[model samples]
Target: MASKDLAMGMTFLTQTVTGILANVVLLFHYFSLCFTGYRLRPTDLIAEHLTIANTVIMLSKGVSQTVQAFGVKYFSQITRCTVLLYVYRVARGVSVSTTCLLSVFQTVKISPMSSRWKQLKAKLPKHIGLSVFLCWSLNMLVNCIFPFYSINKYSSKNTTKIKYFRYCSSGFPDKITEALYAAFVLFPEVSCSGIMIWSSSSMIFILHRHKQQVQHIRRTNVSHKSSPESRATQSVLVLVCSFVCFYTLSSCFYASVVNFSIPSWWLLNTSALISTCFPAVSPFVLMSCNSTASRLWFKFSGFVRRR
Candidate 1:
């Protein structure tokens, strides 16, 4: 028992340290998100939405990580755990919604002239933001039903402490409800991915044709070269790739959880980590792909002109 307790303590400590680091990096990324519109363009709400999504995710992760790092032996009040779970739910909903919106944004940005995907290119962010707000409100209502229900105090002192973290859950209200909800959520996600892939593929095709034409007209003084635009396109591609993998894995894992393939306790400790990983991964991917970020530091320091 003592050895098992020590192992849990070590795991919590390691996880917490990493979680804190993720949040720190996310903070810098959040600034980039803000720069997306406020400095870049306030009307450019996609960057704002992405930043908001990442912020919520990291904060949710911090809440879970801090509590667990208190060590397994430290007992927490019902309010604390309830708060943690709620934070996780909100963060996750924002992350998924924001990512979905971003994927559609990419498709719109790169769609061929004749593609129907271009039609939604303009409305992507607004629709996504509205959808995010809607989903958030729904999640809050659903989660509240559980946390406030049957949240009973135990012990002579009325401790109201979770022996193993109780009061509200990640569990669905019922098996049928969980399955139906999973299908509903999963459908849009799969459809979005498909559309993104098709749109990106068409864009790549167009780019290739343009490249060939430019090569043929190289000495005619009419050829155009891709400069920063190519870099921007590649950066968007990287973001798309990141989500493809992250979303695929996360969706599969959630399906397993809903289907009862994963044990409940394991899901409890580990699921929160996935929230940190998704938004945390995207900004870094964007930084690596974006030449714009390279000029950001120098611009801020007055050492170089803003690109």
Candidate 2:
């Protein structure tokens, strides 16, 4: 429950406007994936996962952002509060799961034959879908408990303010629930992030070794071919760096949000913005690195212009 008019105005201006633009970008990307039809590249796990993540982000943010945008008007109502919490919580889960899947897939793609993670390469697609469904369902449960545990009644002394959850709003959850929520946050993150860093480092090492070999050949031979592979490797390096930085920042923001003592509205807004903006921003990053995506995006742009 928010008491300040300034807060409402801030949320509307800072969160609402940015969120609307981010969601518009996300929807465009998601629809573009479907329109270009995963038909051309049905076998590419990276392509499929990226498209699915974008779609999920768009759906979750689309509902939550709209609800929040209109929430000030419906602040006093029970249904609106429940809807807001449900959408917000579900969106949070979907965001985390999609990111975890992305990191894991990238890691597996770059890993060696003897890599312990090779088994995942075969089962990952089915596993990712199942994981998404289960995560969404389970996270929705945590959010649903809010309706039963939370209260949206007006403040005793004022007409403007509202209070949520008489008992459940404050601190630590119950033993079982706390454990479950903690597991949800920790398990995938530690595992996914560890593998991502390892695999990324491995790729960078491989690229460097190849570069060294090329340099050796250049030193001995009078004529050396200036190749595009170096450029491709540089692009991949840039792509990896972008993903790592954005995802790390988003995770940090989310961690701060879990602490009940945090009072910064900007932190909350940034966290939400990062979650929604990733899907929209990621395609641009990928397209910048890959000629195929760049061409497809241009083709899609031309089609949209015709309409």
Candidate 3:
């Protein structure tokens, strides 16, 4: 392999390995909490699903890209390409949906407890599982078209409709079918992004107002630290901002690829790398921001040090 290809392969390999490990640790922590008789918060439940989706993206997209970058003929078959493409698309959609859900849930969580808010707050936790289930089911249904359109890279050379990727290719449909598919895919993504922006803005406003109200009291009380809600809000804000930044860049790269009649190999690699950034970084974000995860990490580190 060329030096550039080697570097890109290593980058992808590092990202995939790191992301998978971080997500595994987080997932195991959550499951351990459950087994230890700890009741998981609703946000924890949503986060677990996000971790799973991120892991899937790492495996299906990140690992494949890495293998292909290193000059391996992975996903050389039509069936393998189809299955991986389907799974990656579904997982990518679910990641967006779950992140939007997390932001909205946190916004409602920290809102002032009015009667309307009270009812929502009371009912929201009960439905978190259902919400996550719907995210998975809807994404799966929407991305079912992938299997029909996916082709191996070698097969793409015979067809005029093929859109090139690093390891696999996507068969573009007729104009009407393409428009319909784009609509189904873009609508949910746009809606989720809008929700995330609105929720993040609401959270910022709420946090600012609370800070102002408590400023004098905090100054007077030496021991007063930030509240749990405040910490959680800050974490969600960071999560939302990071997700939006990475997702937007990824979308732009993806758009560039789609716009070109034949996208360059570097463009393909750049798009794939940008697409995996959020997934690779998000677990560490959660681990650092979440007190429970932080504590668990510290304990684990200390235990390792003793050994």
Candidate whose lDDT is highest: 3
| Model 1 misplaced regions, further than 4 Å | 1-44, 69-81, 112-174, 184-195, 198-203, 217-226, 257-272, 289-307
RMSD of 1: 7.0
Q: Report how far residue 141 has shifted in candidate 2, in Å.
A: 9.3
TM-score per candidate? 0.63, 0.59, 0.92
lDDT of each: 0.54, 0.53, 0.84
Each candidate structure's count of clashing pairs? 1, 1, 0
Best by TM-score: 3
Whole-model lDDT, candidate 1?
A: 0.54
Ranking by lDDT: 3, 1, 2
Clashing pairs in 3: none
lDDT of 1 by residue, 1-307 (tens): 3664456446655554544444455445546666666443211345445555565655555444545544532425554556655565555555555555555565466565677766666666456556656656765664554343224333323222222333232434455755575565456558667765765575577568757766756767664556555555666667767767777776666555545523465564455445356676665554554445434533443642333
Cα RMSD (Å) per model?
7.0, 6.9, 2.5
How many clashes (backbone atoms < 3 Å, residues ≥3 apart in a chain or on different chains) does model 3 have?
0
Alpha carbon deviation, residue 177, candidate 1 (Å) = 3.4
